[model samples]
Target: MESLQALQDFIKTKDNFRNFVNSSEVPSVCKTEPCMLGVDEAGRGPVLGPMVYGVAYCPLSQTSVLKDLGCADSKALTEEKRDDIFRKMLTEEASLNNVGWAAEIISPNYISNSMYRRAKHSLNEVSMNSAIDLIKKVAESGANITEVYVDTVGPPEKYQAKLSEIYPNYKITVAKKADSIYPIVSAASIVAKVTRDHALKVWQFKEGLEMTHAEFGSGYPGDPLTKKFIREQVDYVFGYPMLVRFSWSTAELMLQDKAATCTFEEIDDELPKKKVKSISSFFSVKSEDGAMKRKRHKFFEERYLSMDNAFE
Candidate 1:
């Protein structure tokens, strides 16, 4: 009885402990240099829906506004909280630009490769273009842009290379976790996530697919609901919908498993013959000096099929 009473007393002191922790004094906003644009992206790992990327420009004058808004990583917030923040950002802030890359449905065999290559390419292209556009607009309005910071997707150097390829005139810095360090990047994260969620909702409505409250998460592989959605769609007899990235390895594996379960002799016969490809003959490779070399490497490279080409 004494131990139970002590536990109750400890529980009663929780609010006081919280108040003590919260009372620690700290500066509201960290000082940062002016005129740097922060860029970040969202929706890269989702098995379904389009990848959304965003860029936000903070001109250093509004640092306190960001701090007051509680600008931090979007992943750290609940969906409702993110939506609230997103709304506040759009209404109150005028220096933000959000862009998205929508990958339409292709056949399942190509989803993983297509997403990794083409989807990423598309997202990067869009992000760069949007950043350039926003910077140009800001400059025309008499705002100076000294540097641009981006949350690195692949590598820091690669971003510089790609940005140079896209926009040779501007200077850019690409670093991993820029979103966590920079308020502008955090704002971009919010825009990208909110935009993606809206797009997903629209897609779900258009496809006539019904989902429970927990069905759509951040679309990461870690989400059980996402995995379940993928499994259900893969096993569906009518074929996958137009929203699915069919090139994913998971989709291909599911399709191969389904094909294996079939009892059709015609399919079985076609399978083995199809598997045996005379690679040298197909590529017209010359077997010289005990080495096979193709005249054109492009012929052996995987072709990226678009959504329209996938069905055909």
Candidate 2:
């Protein structure tokens, strides 16, 4: 395990647009006793900084150790309280014996790239995959994981089903407020929230913004400082720095209204037809009113499919 300062320094060294993981050595007790793992995330709503998915595992019988460390509902805890709990998790002998944790930091640029790709990937998919990967990493690190708990915002049944399918041997529970209901999940939430807070604090803008995190305040769209940054700190050609998620509506709409307009060529999803067909089609499909109607492929016609003017 790294000291808090070491973790922050490590995060600062990485490229702002890439994803990375930080993990502790698996506890000796975890390999011998049946363990429960909890997963949760933070910063999903923030337009600034990285979203963090965190997983924490401990022996099923030693959950009381977490309580002693002050692990509870992370959202209910103050920043100082959360930091104290995390500090104990790093330094306390009892916690070191029973608990192990890992966090994946999903960068804002990565989120934007995934959503803006030719075949768009939704934020839900990104969040799910990050959680799954953390679980896999913990299992591979020699934890005898038998139960898994996840806190999620969307419908739990589908998420639970997906996790159950992936790890049939383990008992899986995906709930709306698992962080508050489960101690292990609360621990995971603390890990995620603390990591996200530090990530923003240590953020070094490659685009050379002179202001610090305090100037930008929280990354929520409603924050006055964040709104000011988005409104005033746009580049005419490249838009905001990597810290801002371009795919987010808050950033996209601001860029559209404030920056120079850029129109990209439309994506072509079909193969080009031969020139020979073009000459025949020009003369063959004229209506009685002298409007040209392009002939459709037999396969499309049979299915009653018509071309759509995407631009219109």
Candidate 3:
């Protein structure tokens, strides 16, 4: 998006539960010169809002432009600084000529569904797939990408090997804190972090909560506003709105305490089905023994009342 308002407008129109992408046009110089792309994510730990994966690419010769734009460890930068850098990416002549970026917003509902399915898909898989998709999309748009740097989602060596296997020609480096070490990855982090911040800022609750993101805070369990939202906003049958990630333990535990308990019939195809007695067995009368029956209540006993077979 060219501006924060434009990003908010775009997010408002989409189905909140579905994943979507937004990207800038690949600069002509990027297509002609060998380029490097970096990948990073935001909102991975939050119980609310979408997780965003962003990729930033530029010609290898123009890496200096990233430094000029003040790209650094995104986590260390204030929210205002990230927003300013992103705005510069939109307006600055040097940045526009050299840098291209893309982001995929992975919705909380999509994440919950992935993790809750019978054959569960972990969050790491969802994250890696999003990163791969963004990189491929950049390449398909004719960026001459020769190297990829990634902030690790899980184990660095394993993730690096996986990306290398998929893009044999491209050099891939996946490591912890790559956002701090690589300027391109830092730019990607800014893109992802800014997108996620705006996503929550403009969140429209399809469940009709009549509330704003401010009311829910940052979606971290430690945030008092978020904790209050989780404690108070609950549906007995369906649980919380799509804004909350149902698969997160924070959401799951809160829902368990506040919502109605629901059970489903579980079928196992591998186990042999046992033939059981009919439903009538539950009501069948057994032969009475000489043993004493249950005592009558005091009220009945005081009246010398007795229970007998009405039909007899």
Candidate 4:
């Protein structure tokens, strides 16, 4: 982030956005250097603001640059400490010249929409797709990518196999806690955390709510302030604003308990269904294809045809 004013100015009504940083900081010749990229994310477990996916890459031979910049376990760092490290990366010559970073700010609305889709896209899928896109974007821009390291909570084998299939040329490594083990992934995590922090810091409400992030706590469902917000700042009809991931059970359950009674009518609009033939149709008639031929109702006509006498 450039400045508080700049971050505030960057806020938009759009659900998601992306930013690339330090692209020009690296010399053009560095593009030919064997690049190793790292991927990580922030706010995945939060119900507030946006979940940010960040990718950081540099020449494989320049691995020492990240270490020198103190790119280590982000979870071990204080918020202020993380901010200082990111600022140094942006302002320092040695760090800036060696690193290129990009981030995808996946909005809560996007998450809700994806998870609520007819087919339902899982959050892991969305995160993986974002990471994949970032990697491909950097490679397409002419970085000589050789190895990719990813930080993930899910099974590493599946994710590694998926990425290997996509970028078969690159050596892919997806592991649990790569952020703590790989400096590049740590750097990416710092970038993601800072980006998401700023996103929440400058979150603009379109729902006319007069509150701030301080009142919403850390966006974790367990956060006292977040639970308070879900219970207190709800609309009778819409529940929370677009900033909240409605698909999350925390928000949904809160809304159901505290907000208005909401009901949904599932519209089965798929060609009025196939109209499965009744079991009796099998015995009634058969078509040329040896299946039931749906016939018109004939209960009254059949009753009259079966009568022995008209009076009886």
**Candidate 1's residue-wise lDDT over 120-204, tens digit each?**
6444454455455544544454444566777876677977787766656557777889888877778767766765565555343
Sort by lDDT, top down from the best? 3, 2, 4, 1
The TM-scores of all predictions, comma-separated, are 0.57, 0.84, 0.84, 0.80
Highest lDDT model number: 3
Q: On residues 41-135, what C-alpha lDDT tens digit does candidate 3 reach at each position?
A: 99999988899999999999988889998999889999999998887776546345589999999999999999999999999999999999999
Evaluate model 3: give its TM-score.
0.84
Clash count in backbone of candidate 1:
7
Report the C-alpha displacement of residue 43, candidate 2, in angstroms: 0.4
Clashes of each: 7, 0, 0, 0
lDDT of 4 by residue, 1-312 (tens): 344345445555343333323222444545878988889999999887788888788888888888877888777888888877676655545345578777788878889989999999999999899899988878878777899999985799999999999999999999999999999999999878877887787777877777777878889888988888877877877788887899999888888887789567777764467878778766775669877565645985776554457566
lDDT of 2: 0.88
RMSD of each: 17.7, 9.6, 15.0, 9.3
Clash pairs, candidate 2, are none
lDDT of 2 by residue, 148-239 (tens): 99997579999999999999999999999899999999999999998888889999988888788899978999999999989888999888
Candidate 3 stretches greater than 4 Å from native: 92-97, 266-312
TM-score, prediction 4: 0.80
Consecutive 10-residue window with the lowest summed lDDT within model 3:
303-312
